[model samples]
Target: MDEVPGVPAGLLGGHPRVLAAAAATGRLPGRAALDDYRAAGARAAESGVPLRVLVETALVMAESMDPVPLPALRRAVSALMEGYENAQRLALRQEEVARREFVDDLLQGRADRLAERAEHFGLRLAETYAVAVARPAVPLDDGSVRDGTVRDGGGVVRDGGGVVWDGDGPARRIEEAMVARFGSHNVLVAVRDGGLVCVVPGSLTVATGEFTHHVRQMFAPGWRVGLGRPHRGPGGVVTSYREATGAIELGDRLDLRAPVLKAADLLVFPVLLRDRAAIEDLVTTVLSPLREARGGPEPLLGTLEAVFASQGNQTAAARRLGVSTRAVTYRLERIRRLTGFSPDDPTQRFTLETAVLGARLLEWPAHAPG
Candidate 1:
């Protein structure tokens, strides 16, 4: 008789029918053979047999033991189930450890064998991918908030207020939800730095708006999402992750009310923030005059914001500000006189618009030291 791998040799030696079943299905016998099956499960776990395969083996073993007395076989099946559960748990735990290590490597850009490691973690490195970062929208009332910077495992410091997420329950729930929306194998989620970061494949074809809407509905209110644009390859994934992080930081700084923010929509902020000295200079040179306006900077700043938001259309700006078009035009004229830059000119408009964005990001007059 041919020997079955990982199965004890002498255990099924006497039963020809059981031996044939084991040989054909790669399942151990059952009933009086419970001990051997349990042992086989342990060996399989150690040998790296997949949990799904082990489960099927257990079911097949129960079916093959049908000729045994019903009550006795039922007891044996119960024992087999326990053994399978233990083996699966052990395998799953080990996989989790390996997966965490891979994620850390990926995030840190230290993964040399990217393709091999990604495949081991059931990820397709070559596929188009995007990264998303989600955090609890509501700050904890407890004074546990830390004042310093919060950095992820990858050592990327996301500039935002920190929250101490105390448990894995929410993270796990998010992972399950993402897997349900995008298939289990296509999405990899890990909780890092008190937030959930997910690497999801683009093959799911879910639109960004729809994806964020679904995520918001799945979680509790006040959950904010930062989604990155899709890019190809593992390096692209890292880039997307950085974009997602930047989106969150920018959104928070700007006090954007939208629950979901896309990185692509806010690329200009990062570019402007890249040169701190330059942005500060621009704000000082163009907007400093507004601080000395007749009614103080608030009214002029409000007018400027309204006009820019309305795309330089004085009529639209006036409607938004609940004032007459002539009033809006007069404010724009005052702005030009004070700053020597007219909002109506294309070149000056670009400069003023950029400066306005910089002021918002820096919290300008509000950021002035007390």
Candidate 2:
């Protein structure tokens, strides 16, 4: 690059190599915009565009009309500047293409590797991940993501940026940056969508509880998240993704705090059904009538557990039963009325607590032994 004549000696800029270096790599930090610049340069180089054109343009832009003013030379400089403009526009378009292609390749290569890493780290890729998609602060269409920010793992679930995400602070910050980039409100950052997903390893620890808590705080209003049931593998992500989406919709309908759903939560109903067999018939039928007819009759289940637990201490039993001394007396009188046993008697408290536990488990209605 030549110095423009009559321009101050210190005003030395427009070195093509310097521009290349600045645009091609980083001296400080970088933005996504910088990536475009680099991509453009790479395309220009690969397309066999002559670097001489770029270099010559820099020389023309650097020249100043000082002591020697030539009209033809000035025209040449103007033509060169215009050429630079065209070159820059070409570079920008090429950079955009390069970015899309790069994102495609990056996502493709990284998915399986993420699966492998999750396995090595004891995160089951088969286990469902909570997909939380986000984009820039701008509104993106449903299932949209910015290039380089989210890599598509295919079919509505994108595996997270495993290695790329490691030292970049917590994944939440990455989501926040994406939001800023897209200039969007709380956008769903999912695979192919504004989905920000967490591969919640199937293993449930106390920390998983904490994970759920954090998941709830991840978004603001007008954004939705779908937490899928724990799936078996990456393929399972599709189903899990569907489940979480359904859950978010359901939560919206039902006014739930967190829209994420877990497969295990559904098992509670089944377990309750199965346990009822042991509870209903074991003790309630055998003891209900006797307790009601006793002279020292009490609510047999409550009194029995208390007395047996207290080992016949009237005071302690009364405290455990949440009753006053006089109430305890009245109830105790009713207890002996039917069961032919006094709670004051030591041997009887044993049978009483056993019966109490049985009745409690059965969820049987209370009775005063006659």
Candidate 3:
């Protein structure tokens, strides 16, 4: 009997029926060889051989024997393909378990060797990266709940409700989409903190508006995304992740409904919210008159934002507000009389803008305590 190169002798030595069948038919035995091929498939999977290589090896071994009937050879190849596919699925499941463990450790701050661990998963940690977090706009049905936790790309564990969004469907879609755009190795999407989190390469200089538009179009209408500023290194990934979560939290608190919120644009409110007493004081002292205005605080606040956004240009601000320039001037005059701060002066304009920002952050007049 001819020996198969690179295969251990013991593998075939113990399977005499397989050898006899091969000798007689010049092809692997049907049904009889299934057990032997299954063993071979398991070993191939363990050795990390590609399924293509395993299929090729099976064909080569079958052809090496004296001429076998075409029908018999075809049957043998189909059986080998089935065995290889089964083994491949098993191998993939095992790999996913290991990858999830590594990702969990990395996110929990337990993995000290970031570069080494990242490389093991075919990731490059040296490049600039940003984290994006997404949550569903609608709640999932209770029946869809499987375990207390669901492992998507990465895993997330939550308290209270004891449920976190699996994000399996959307997270896979996100990873596939980003990979298609940026290449397979450039993006990583995981499920964390009841949402999908993606680590994408490139600096903030990359047009976030364009990226946000793409995400909004690609994802389902129910998804809301938040992006962090780009930073370098594996450790910086944690910082970026925190920034992404903060953006989502702040956006929800302030009721900003843009499809994607950028952490860079929300830098001030989060810090100001940390000093709640100061924010309250600013609302009380500088914004009290506007709160007591005849038409309510929203109209004046809207005008202030428009004026500031237009850089004190009454004509431009009026255009944006869909009002006449004289109306814009009247609003600014009312603001000056009520708050004792003139919008015409750059210095007072700065203070008034700061106070308005504080009021919005605190949701003053609407939710302020009496």
How many steric clashes between backbone atoms does each model show?
0, 71, 0
Clashing pairs in 3: none
Which is the leading candidate under lDDT? 1
- Model 1 per-residue lDDT tens digits across residues 72-116: 444444554566556665555455556666776787777678789
Give the winner by TM-score.
3
Ordering by TM-score: 3, 1, 2
Candidate 2 structure lDDT: 0.43
The true-versus-predicted C-alpha distance at residue 65 of model 3, in Å, is 6.7
User: If both were scored by TM-score, which would come out higher, candidate 1 or candidate 2?
Assistant: 1
Candidate 3 per-residue C-alpha lDDT over 1-370 given as tens digits, one digit per residue, 9 for 90 to 100:
4655555444334344454466675774666667666676667666666667666655665554555445555665566566666666555544544655666665555766767878766677777778777776643221123565443333342323444433344455655666677665666655454576677775534534434555576555867778888877776777777888788877776656576788999888778878888878877888788866888988898898888888888899899889999998988888889999987888888888888887777777777746
lDDT over C-alpha atoms for residue 148 of model 1: 38
Task: Decide which is better by lDDT, 2 or 3.
Answer: 3
All candidates' TM-scores? 0.63, 0.30, 0.67
Q: After TM-score superposition, what is the CA distance of residue 90 in candidate 3 from its true location, in Å?
A: 3.8
lDDT of each: 0.67, 0.43, 0.67
Minimal lDDT window, size 10, model 1: 150-159
lDDT of candidate 2 over 1-370, digit per residue (tens): 4443443332223233333444345332234433433443344444544545533543465343232233333333344344444455445444433433333332244463555544432345544343322222233322223343423221122223211211122234434454454322222222233444433444433323443444445444445455455556555655555555455544443333444445344333234336655435435444655534544223554666665667667679799778876776766666666555566666665555545554543345433222
